[model samples]
Target: MKSIFDQRRERGGGTREAGPDRATVLSISSHVVRGAVGNRAVVFALESLGHQVWSVPTITLPWHPGHGAGTQIVPDDTAFEAVCRDLAGSPFALEIEAVITGYFASKAQVEASAGLIAALRRTNPDLVYCLDPVLGDEGRLYRPPEVLAAIRESLMPLANLATPNRFELEFLTGLGAHDNGDLIDAARTLGCPQVLVTSAFAMLSGSIGNLLVGERSAELAEHRLIANGPNGGGDLTAALYLARLLEGQSPEKALRLATASVFEIVARTARTGHNEMALQKEAASLSHPMAMVQMRTLAGAKKR
Candidate 1:
């Protein structure tokens, strides 16, 4: 199988430049100098889709923890809060139409981020806030309990959209989602206007699904499962989905495209035997993915 990188190279690096009318997005997440995860993945994906991104790092690491522990640098509370305050007061903050947050280093950082969101929303009442609670996966909590509490109590309510995996959803909701119905119930109960749950129950055998639950719609976008996919898939998904929505695509269309992009990039990365997501090499996939994604409409209940 031809790698996604090869296909992109064959097309002479099919990257789209941001247009003047593109909305500016603020992405606050962890930063790794050498890998495509956190802000690296999110910023690249948004830019590839012709959106400008203002990136802020909650923490800096040499690489993702999955690649083995490296240097982790988190700013002190005072310094972090200062920066957030500066951004909030800056005139440029009003230009940001959306904000996406992931992998906060501390509870203080989460609080500072919530403050920034509030400040921005004050200026732009329709600011889109996507909270991807990057707490943990596989039935474990990687962040401190306090960080989880801050995200749930302070950040979740402010979020217009949320992308939480099955494990993270369980951590946020304190309920066991044993099936799709349970997942839907938990998502609705979480109270986010739009919730996209990754790693949800796939109806098709040997497939993975991105289940989107909204006020009036429930849809699942499924693709073939790839083994040992690289990290940052969730980050990429959240970025692409948010970008699509900001571009005025319908929720279901955004879900399909985001799911296809992540699936294609992950499958390509696995084929190349890479430990990190090849987001830069697969920029074309982010903008114009050709991967096949099966989208289905499921029974949705009215929001309570």
Candidate 2:
């Protein structure tokens, strides 16, 4: 039987012989048993888009702490490194075309992930890595300073793209950006080929935007802001955006699609009065999002 990816490619008038039907992605992040945050959201979004996913949980939680305090478990640093080394040496390492890292519990986990990415790149030189800097939101840093430092020094340099929310971008750049233009400048300074800033300022009131900044161009995709939305929108956006890119979508299109998917799912979750995303019931939103997104080109910042 043809794989889901293969069937989708055929329907899209593509042949498997032209290229691989789908990419295999390694997702490293936190795991929650009762919520769709971190790897739970990332892995589901990727697989729903027809890509193969390998998930590694940096830490495990019974549920997101936003609900209340919960039990958390983090693997030993040495053991985490050992597992990463094992994957690096495995035959499947050559098959991974992309990796996304988020929410490391320790600086050591960040280092281990960096080592794994380096190893995978040796076999697949064109590997795409998206760093989702899961620092605190609302003008504070939730992660330890050392872990943030490791991400800035070690992982940022290795990433092809980065997905940071407005606050996290400020944390990474050490420069406060009050508007989209300032954000474009700060994003460029990160030196990543692509940076997608979520929670960007929207021209339309009561809406949110995702700003995609590149070397020479920028685009914004805006959608209605669901109030008190679920926790995994960033994870879903990063995963869906990467999946779209792997499927050969342009950056602007990927931004629109990803934004639409997240918005749609969040809207669904809100309507159902759920605190977590209704990803299991909203698979169609991930694969074929019908939500309308307002897309517009933005003026790139002048180079210094």
Candidate 3:
């Protein structure tokens, strides 16, 4: 068996002698025992792309609540903060180049996550932070009001990128978005360097889109809408997009590839008639997605 150092080196392309040569991403989210959601989906997606992933779970469940209610095991606030502190002071902290957060179980977890982000930034100022506000979907809220308030107040300002679906974006800005133009405007108001608004308006019939709004540009990657898709698409998309960016792919390419991968997985899972995402079976889609995504540039995406 390979030593721990050798294993880390293989995952991150870093050696004990030469130190970290590739980026390691820290993903904070929920953990499910039987499904591909939260940290399970994100960790697998990132690792499949040859990046070392450090997972921090805000809560644990037997399965996603969507399939029906299950037991939720959440850590105590004090102990959770201590774990965050431990990671902050870890020697491997500097090896982390990106952080992605999703699915906070409580307000305290959101605060602790913000603290960890602040601590990591102290050592690596250029850390890429992606916030996937797991607040709600289809115009409904999943997390409580205080958790939403904490994420809006604490994490939004610190994010380098944000991946919020149309409903979550509306909640974040407190503005109603009727179309892609409204989403572009709201995304600019977010003040993050980049905002990827998923579930955007697709021009074509029977399709869906992921709109990437940057400081000076906007692009949309659309695919056929898969009916009754699984619950892990947002988590998988955020992790895969971050992984591609760490690999030095441009924003457009990253969006296209991530969208394609997610579309492929969802389509495959639908075909297999699985309630949870088929991440383990369709692992190849993560790195080398063969699905074709329609890419287009929005004409009126102006600089702020």
Candidate 4:
């Protein structure tokens, strides 16, 4: 098979024109043929915001596991490594300003991704890598322990920011995140310069929060809890948040927009009784979300 570099050269040696307004992003995640999860949610959200995405799928599934068990296909280790190598050596690799990774299918894939990130950063030091550690949720371990370890050790150090849900934060830091204070402490311990903790405790009744923990500040974006909402909320949140930041929005502003967009999509999905996120039908929300997200300053948040 022709490598990615070879394929690109055959078409043209020039980088793909994304227009001056759009930034290029490389997104690596799972791909579900039937649901809006993993790369499906991420690629659509980024592209909806007028960004070009270089999507790489770690695993392929018929649909999300929540719907039912389906055939899972993961590329062999050598094949995956070869693809990563091709991308890293491609002339257009420098066009990528950001990378978002989630749902690695294996430990080898995690290492391959880390290697690609390292190679990209060597040429573009300003590269932003968002690590969404999709291990498990609701007090359970969905991925193998080795996969979790690879993320913590191999990928965490290369990440500019991390979006981990409350459960994932605890698993990564080995610390309890029962309250906002605990969440902040755990975020710091995780060693990421910036961290966003979703599914955080909310001050208002019947609401959930996304907490942003930075070097010197912390904020929470809270919205109404939509019960029985469709899957892929976190995937969408991580993607949009990165997109907003790439657009030069402040951390606080980015948090608000990402939180609002996800909340809007979740509420809409629930109203329609859909099993998956209606991201395609609701693509406008990714760019112009009208949902209100209550933002608050977390007092006494420690500064490092």
Candidate 5:
């Protein structure tokens, strides 16, 4: 087992020991240096779950993006492709059991990601590719329109699993956003084997809304709505879901674990008014969330 000190030091400055493969999961997404969002939370969650995580920061923003600050661009397409190629030939190459992607800062990144997915699949055909398509929200297009079109057509189809919010789901599926409509209808129309939606509040009543985690067939159990959370929390949610998938967990169990993990972190975020990706503190104090009345009640039902 790799010690905590060794793992942190090895990133750039350590002469240290190598850890076990145990199905390494690569976390690729936009970077947030000064603040939190996207890959920050998801990668942290995956690490917390004891998975060996390799991260690729796609782009770096100056501040919290929710505040509408601009971000800086990194290696162009050629550089990005070179990095992917390098990874494919590296020692950790064989351990990449999955590649989880989010927030493509440019069209080049999207194309490179698609290529990496192909390369990873070529080596480990069973490698799970989970894509959290960060296209846009609530009918708003976040990236360029062409990027949206590329994700809808080129990128998403290659994913074994893709976690998209309701707004993003609508844009990808051509179904307009409707709060009361059947989630199954949306899932079926979307065409992915499994679809986990993060924002679907109509299933819950007043006080706070719920998150619906659904699967295709009747045999698959439905994860009832979960506690409230802020935007970009989906990054954490998707990470948890992917970790479970990589662990060989069943669809139903994956959903349950994902729900439990997300709600636990969200409760802390809610209290602290912090970014959704801020799970470092909460994950450390997981006992508190498990002991919460609401979480405990939900967990009790699960244990039953």
Candidate 6:
């Protein structure tokens, strides 16, 4: 017997043809088509949401060259920057309904990506930006100090919503993450309008998961933390959360869907110990397997 994730990939009865209605999403990331943990998970999640994704791959990949696998950077920063600028200037009018951004391998990529976001917003102010500040995780930095610096100074303030785990949360806020006072306070001060934090392993004891999502400032709803845990989770969390929010679900409802959907997917994925992304191609049957988490508004606040 195969895992739920594996089952989905099977013929007929599987999720092979299952998923959302018909939403369009633009996925902007580095080496997007490559088989890495991030983009692979993202592609499947969006498609599962029933959205058609149009990607703007920032670089070419022979394959995901991870540690010891030998990394190579070509396509000079100047060339990459030019492409992004041209993309932003395209006369073809971007058909994007929603946008998601992730990892930047260099400072040039960061600046260019941020500029693209600004350009996209200018083109369609109502568009939603779902950003994953992949600067680092678990107190470790993924990019050089300059790249992190660039993200902090350039891209963050432009996001409508952000999906960052606890460690990334610390870099974003510069506070002691261990203290609830510092952590919660930091959540209230981030650049985006909504900040979603996936607490680290330390916050999890067993089959339980604890995550936080809150408004930056002058918010109507109270901050949230879902204590129910799931396996191979965060990617699905951010995608479902963004989809719900973009579809006009309130923050609380968005969190609910995100949590529920992520849990369902993980429960399914756990059955497949193989590559985490095998679920990508079988989205239809599995995307929205759970019910919505109902949220009540706090009902009062000042505009920041």
Per-residue lDDT of candidate 4, residues 1-304 (tens digit) = 4422233335342233664445699999999999899999999999998889999999999999998899999999899999999999999998997899999989999999999999999998767889999999999988998999999999999987899999999999998766899889889877777799999999999999999998667899999999999999999999998887776666799899999999999999899999999998988888899999999999655443
Please provide, for model 2 over 11-44, each residue's C-alpha lDDT reduced to its tens digit, 9 standing for 90 to 100. 5522323245577889999999998999999999
TM, every model: 0.92, 0.93, 0.92, 0.93, 0.78, 0.74
Candidate 2 residue runs with Cα over 4 Å from true position = 1-19, 302-304
lDDT of each: 0.87, 0.88, 0.87, 0.89, 0.63, 0.58
lDDT of 1 by residue, 110-166 (tens): 999999999999997767899999989998788998999999999999998999999
> Hey, what RMSD does candidate 1 come out at?
7.4
Residue-by-residue lDDT tens digits, candidate 5, 1-304: 4322123234332121223323477888987765557777767777776677789988877765776758576667788878988887677677676788998877877887788788778887666778899987766878898888888777778876778877788778776545424444655565565676666543223322223333324122223343444556678778876766555555555566676566666665776766444566668532123422121111100111
Tell me each candidate's RMSD, in Å, in order. Answer: 7.4, 4.8, 5.9, 6.8, 8.3, 9.4
Quote the positional error of residue 222 for candidate 2 in Å: 0.6
Query: For model 3, how does the per-residue alpha-carbon lDDT over 158-185 read when each residue is reduced to its tens digit?
Result: 9988999999999999878878888998
Backbone clashes (count) for model 4: 0
**TM-score of candidate 1 versus the correct structure, residues matched by position:** 0.92
Which scores better on lDDT, 5 or 6?
Answer: 5
lDDT of 2 at 291: 98
- Measured on C-alpha atoms, candidate 2 has an lDDT of 0.88
Show pairs that collide, candidate 1.
none
Tell me the number of clashing residue pairs for each predicted model.
0, 0, 0, 0, 0, 7
Q: Output candidate 2 Cα RMSD.
A: 4.8
Checking candidate 3 for backbone clashes, the offending pairs are none
Inter-residue clash pairs, candidate 4 = none
